[model samples]
Target: MDDNLIFAVIGAGNTGQAMAGYLKLKGFAVRLYDRSEWRFKSLRKHSMRLSDEIVSSQKIDLLTTNLNEAVHGANFIIVSTSTTAHIEIAKRLSEILTNDQTILLHPGRTGGALIFKKILRENRPDLKITIGEFESSIFTTRVSATGSTVHYYGIKNGVHFSTLPAVDVRKIFQILKIYFLKLRPIRMCSTLL
Candidate 1:
């Protein structure tokens, strides 16, 4: 587990903020991005107040806008945005990302990874894409609305991830285990839908 792995978390909403805080605590360089202006503001305010506790001590870097800038050199990209924006975001990211990049879809619902794969294929057929999934995103985490801070109640119950063709599962899991030590790999079945 490399402590220097850079992580870009899209969608600075509740889930995004919670995960960012936790990842920072684990010593990963994390940057956050969101399309919503409100979310961006919230993240900034929270970061400012928790600067000593979350930023200064942990050295977590927070970025609200500029998707390309946040993700350009990141080793891992975590998509925590709503389902409606999933396709568009995936399409935009596919254009800029290289084949070696790893993408994790938090709270990957039915067909989420498949949809991303389809869009990537339509745009960059030659590029190999590998999208992973989790049992749930956030791990029962919550952020306080009053103080605009985060609270991680418990570790993730389980994180289930699978890559296309299944050959890249080990590599993906190895990277994930750094941040999520309790992650459990799910057996692949014919239906990813």
Candidate 2:
């Protein structure tokens, strides 16, 4: 378990920042990414706010504006942005995603996962990548009063996750349980209906 597994959070928004900080707090290697370089400056601000909660000097492994740098070597990439941008993000990811990487929308909208998976398949027929989506964001989050720290308001239980290639459910769950203890794998067939 000590093998440095990299977790990349692909947005710098409230949900993404909190997720990344909490993951870093939990001792996982984390990389934070946003298209804007200015958003990358969040670490210096978040680290201080999370200091009391984490009780240790946990910090994100890297922060970058380049998507390629963010996803490279990341075992799992969480697309924490709003579902509105899933298509655009999917297009970008299809271009550089490696075969070994797995990506999932933090909170999937109707048919969002399938749409994303379809794009990946069409673009990279040569690669077998795992894709999935959560029923909703695991953490209800917002920036703190200080305006730098992401404050998690709540954790909803029984949150469902549906992955592509239904057979990979167990494998994907094993990966997610490491950080998101609240996730429960549900039938992809059932969710589609």
Q: Pick the candidate with the highest TM-score.
A: 2
All models, RMSD in angstroms: 3.2, 2.6
Clashing pairs in 1: none
Separately for all candidates shown, the number of backbone clashes (residues 3 or more apart, or on different chains) is 0, 0
Candidate 1 per-residue lDDT over residues 1-193, each given as its tens digit: 6778889988776677767777887777898887766655545554523332243323349666788977888888889887888888988898788777778888675667788888888888887657776657746655566526665556565667776546677878877776677788764565643
Any idea what lDDT model 2 has?
0.78
* lDDT assessment of candidate 1: 0.72
CA shift of 61, model 2, Å: 1.5
Q: Write the per-residue lDDT of candidate 2 for residues 97-152, one digit (tens) a residue.
A: 88878887888856788888878878988878888788888887776555456666
| C-alpha lDDT of all candidate models, in order | 0.72, 0.78
**TM-score, per-candidate, Cα-based:** 0.85, 0.88
